[model samples]
Target: MTTARRGRPGYDLESLLQVAVKLFNERGYDGTSMEDLSRKLGITKSAIYHHVPSKEELLRLSVDRALDGLFEVAASTEQLDGRAIDRLEHLVRGSVLVLADRLPFVTLLLRVRGNTKVERSALARRREFDRLVTDLVKQAEAEGDVRPDIDPAVAARLLFGTVNSLIEWYRPRRGSSGAELADAVCKMAFDGLRA
Candidate 1:
């Protein structure tokens, strides 16, 4: 067997996590093994262990990165300080940006089936984010910015469903940016929902 390269100065934890996340996205968290990761990184399994304790830890870290991006947007001053309708729009646009920027991590997050403890935790956090958006929808409805005819919970689900579906088919166009795509989502979502 060819011993993989060793002592590469650039193989830090962050870079290793990126490779691990990409592999997880491709092969799935449950299907991927440390051996597969080592082979893909061209490093020994020992080298990978030096960065993370185990594959589950890597999965936790990756999903956390995706979750953090979302929570940060929800907690941002812009998201908190606006009209309920505008704040909801900011959250939707921010989610699209996160999905575009961290496509692999977000994709893995969305596909997690709760088979592991890490995956279950990720799902719980996702539900919490959904609740926050639901609250925003309710506030918008109360403020008359959003139509009161639709249930807030259902509206939030549909709104996020549209945004989350980006993970399935979004690809980077040559000139279009995440912001541009987010603008389109906000326009399409709000134009119909706004009262």
Candidate 2:
């Protein structure tokens, strides 16, 4: 009998993604396989596949969830107006919170190796996100809201680099939810990093 055939109930889509993210980080995306995932979840491979078409689909969905919140913040009314500095602050704060809320998924998105077609697509979307933010940074510099010494492209990457790094050490505390962690991220990224 298959391992999953004898185990407890299989996890739902969200639960599966959470497990997959953890495994992707632990084993490296290239190292993990459907069998490994099924074994880990104690569910049949078919059961896993039923929830997600393929491992690539799981990766795509996970990355999209992380990116959606970010894109929303970029397009928000608060981001469209105000001093370039304020808009940049909103972007940074919103990004930090989104990253915190979706840390595992975002971390997985950042670690994509392009070993699969799905990863390459995710990489492309990530570049688009960077491009949008870079434009904002450039506008901020033009408005004297940010230090002009730094290149906007470089600044955008640096800001995201700092915020995304939260996944490396951040964990939800006993009383904190992912949203709370996101709030903390916003405070540190904008208020703390600004000149």
Find the candidate with the highest lDDT and give its number: 1
lDDT of every predicted structure (CA atoms) = 0.89, 0.79
lDDT value for model 1: 0.89
Query: Which residue ranges in model 2 land beyond 4 Å of their true spot?
Result: 2-7, 77-79, 175-195
lDDT (10s digit) by residue, model 2, range 80-110: 7577767776777777777767788888888
Which whole-number lDDT from 0 to 100 does residue 145 have in model 2?
76
Q: TM-score winner among the candidates?
A: 1
In model 1, the Cα lDDT at residue 43 comes to 83
TM-score of each prediction = 0.92, 0.85
- Cα lDDT tens digits for candidate 1, 101-176: 9988899999999998999999999999999999989989999999888899999999999998998899888898
Q: Give the TM-score of candidate 2.
A: 0.85
Instruction: Supply every candidate's count of residue pairs whose N, Cα or C atoms clash at under 3 angstroms.
Output: 0, 0
